[model samples]
Target chain A: MCTYRTTTLTVAGSGKGAEGWFPVTDASVYFDHPVHAPADHTLNVDLRNPSRGASARVAVELDPVSARALALAILDMLDSAPAGLVDAATPSGVPPAG
Target chain B: MTPGDLTAETVTITGHGGDAVEAYLAQPLAGPPAGGVVVIHHMPGYDAGTKEIVRKFAANGYPAIMPNLYFREAPGASPDDAAAVARAAGGVPDERLVGDVAGALGHLRALPGSNGKVATIGYCSGGRQSFLAACSLDLDAAVDCYGAFVLTAPPDEFPLQVGPLGHLVGDLSCPMLGLFGADDKYPGPEEVAEFEAALGRAGKDVEFHSYEGAGHAFFNTDRPSFRPEAANDGWERIWEFFGRHLSA
Candidate 1:
């Protein structure tokens, strides 16, 4: 089944793609058929630069459980960092774009 | 061009508001004035598997073409990347899809060997699009391979650009063949029955088969969802359906 469920957002970050590091202005998260994964469906993310060709993307397809775990791990890693280490880039009251 | 010899190539054709779009064209070696088919690729985009389907049509003596629905969004990029871009762009608009199909039909008819007959077959998301094209155009035949969202709407959170097309049943211009899996949820047995009832009420010529123990995407050979038993029988049904309507 084509899940067609998608969430897209604009982000400010640098992602290393096939060519190298490029500024990624867009992110798309969807649970649907994977391009390369062996499973029928996956939680997939694409960090991309629309100005660049579509090839300018870093993508990952993870199963639902792994995707949830990865999300928690990301929060955990951020929380464990020294106070203000990650927040130095952005002042309080402004949430991270991604 | 010999009838049995076949070749496939990428070409450019006018599409969707006269845009020059990349497309795959496969033709038998010699122009045998044969019928044509337009294959609409699944949501995975115009990838390798879809190309193989176009080639298979040519080998079976039908000239076929598949317009790269994502060419405008991600030209020269990989199929997966292009698909991502297209998906982020809110999927293909219904008007654009109709225009692309019309362009492909024109290209096929211009062939020296065209028999002036055309049919369409689409899998997954393309399945619903195939029905849309058949309803919107003067097509002779159409095959819907487990197309969802034709009779039911996706959850509101999904915001899929498509909507239920039950209202269009009155406009269908051709005979239709639907192949489905009994276990598929998107257009499970209940939805399929609703679609059939609509077709019946419209007094349209249609045939549908729902396989037992099979689920969504049962025809996708690459995915784990592939069910050989269902796919084989589905293919046989497709050939027979096309043979009846596509032949001169």
Candidate 2:
């Protein structure tokens, strides 16, 4: 089994999938779960009041090869999710978008 | 070109309907504009962060221009209103976007200190605009940071779909650097494959890199989605690619 260090990152915004932007809320979630479980791991991302908003959750283990790849995935999410798709005007929370 | 000196100026240029595009232009205070860079804004419109990006470029000795691409649309329409606009104009033809980009290029060339050699760099919606500029404009290079594609299908098209970017590769004249995240739904394996295939066929130089463990929109520092490592890598690549193709 591979050793993994997990850190939760807060993301606040509004939409469905990864395209949701315009976050009125301060949302936070761990960028990746401890997938050192050897194989693949599944983590649940709960977005507070997601309602028609974009929701995306990915579990990545910080391995030698996967580090850069995972970092790029986060960038892609930000690239696709512009600030126009969200509905929250002044959101303040760090819950995962379920 | 001064390594760190920067000059900022506000300029207005004619836009569609003769509506002026008010932009903040920046470049190294000491050098002739090595090349022109039109920085496209995110979908939410121009904000303080967007302005900061322009200044960063100016400080780097590149004449950077960030136009209000959404100035013709709603003024940062509220969340409730944004949905309606996306539903309505989201399907707008790419040709229209090309025209707008052309207008921006025209303005950049007309700047008293500009040298006319130009490149396009876009973020999010601006990413799409950057790619479109590469397709239609005679740009020297292009940097597309996780831009969505125009598959020309219905609104239900999945971000993973590859059919939309077919035309983009077909029309590309210059090399492009596509920065994406491996876990992003928009640039899933299928989409990357499609772009790779297109680049192979066109014999165009295209570099596609995906950062693992990251999700969508990770390059924007103003938001929590920012991944410092990935953003730095992408930014480094952008500068290298531009220097290789645009700089003498």
Candidate 3:
């Protein structure tokens, strides 16, 4: 069955796609039929930069367990970072204070 | 150009709103005038597997074409990329799908040596679209392979723009065939039954088969869901059904 449900978010990051590195502005995550995964369905994610064209995308298809683990690991790494260092990174469109 | 040989190529056709859409067309070089088929790719987008299906129809002596439903979203993009873009935007709109399929049917009919008969065959989401097209167009036959959301709506949380198509059964313009897996939860046995009953009540011609040991995507050779036994039999049924309705 094609799940047809997707979670999309605006993301700020750079991803290496077929054409090279591009600023990714969006992310779409879904669990449905995979394009190349061996499983019937996998947790699929696509980081994309629509302004750069559809080819400007980085995609990954992971098993449920792996996807959960990866999600937790990302949160853990973020939590472990120094608070000051995390705060120093400017958010999108904000100018750094001199 | 021989009876057993087929030619496959990419061509552009006007789709919804007269937009140029990319499509893959396959036809036997030499064969008696026969019916054509419009192959609808599953939600995974127009990848190699679906293209192979289009060629299969041609190899079996039916000229076939598959329009890239995502062409407008991502022209020249890889199949996976285009699929992602489309998915993020919510699945294709039903109105647009109808227009694109109408264009495809027109293209098939205009092909040289056309028998003036055409049918539609779709898998997964394509299956639902196949039924939708049949309700909206003049077709000889329509095949629905495990298509969901025909009798029941998607979960409320789902972002898909489509809805149950039961209301359109009365308008179906062609004979219909449905192939389903007994274990598929989306269109599980109950949903399939309801859809069949509705069609019957509408006084429409319909046939259905449910394979006990198979689930969704049994015909997809590249996935773990592929059930050779079921897929093989399904192919046989498709050939028989098409032969009955599509052939001159």
Clashing pairs in 1: B1-B30, B2-B30, B5-B29, B33-B113
Provide the global lDDT of candidate 1 against the true structure: 0.90
Q: What's the C-alpha lDDT at position B17 in model 3?
A: 98
Best by lDDT: 3
Residue pairs with backbone overlap in model 3: none
Per-residue lDDT of A8-79 in model 3, one digit per residue for the tens? 999887899888998989999888988888898899999999999889999999999999999999989878
The candidate 2 chain B region of ten consecutive residues with least summed lDDT is B153-162
What does TM-score give for chain A of every model?
0.86, 0.28, 0.91
True contacts kept of each: 0.71, 0.00, 0.73
Weakest lDDT window of 10 consecutive positions for candidate 1 chain A = A89-98
Model 1 spans > 4 angstroms off: A91-98, B1-4
How well does candidate 3 score on lDDT at residue A21? 91
lDDT of 2 by residue, A6-93 (tens): 2223455453434544443222222222213332222212332323332232212354356566668988875676574333333543
Residue-wise lDDT of candidate 2 within B1-248, one digit each (tens)? 44788888767766555667666688777865577788876654566677888888777767787766554444343322332232223422455556666777788777666766788888765666687778887988888777655333312422122235556677787888888777765556566667767777988888888888665567767554678888899889988887787674
lDDT of each: 0.90, 0.60, 0.91
- Put the candidates in TM-score order, highest first: 3, 1, 2
State candidate 1's TM-score: 0.95
Chain A TM-score, candidate 1?
A: 0.86
Ten-residue stretch with the least lDDT total in model 1 chain B: B152-161
Residue B53 alpha-carbon offset, candidate 1, angstroms: 0.5
Docking class of 3: medium
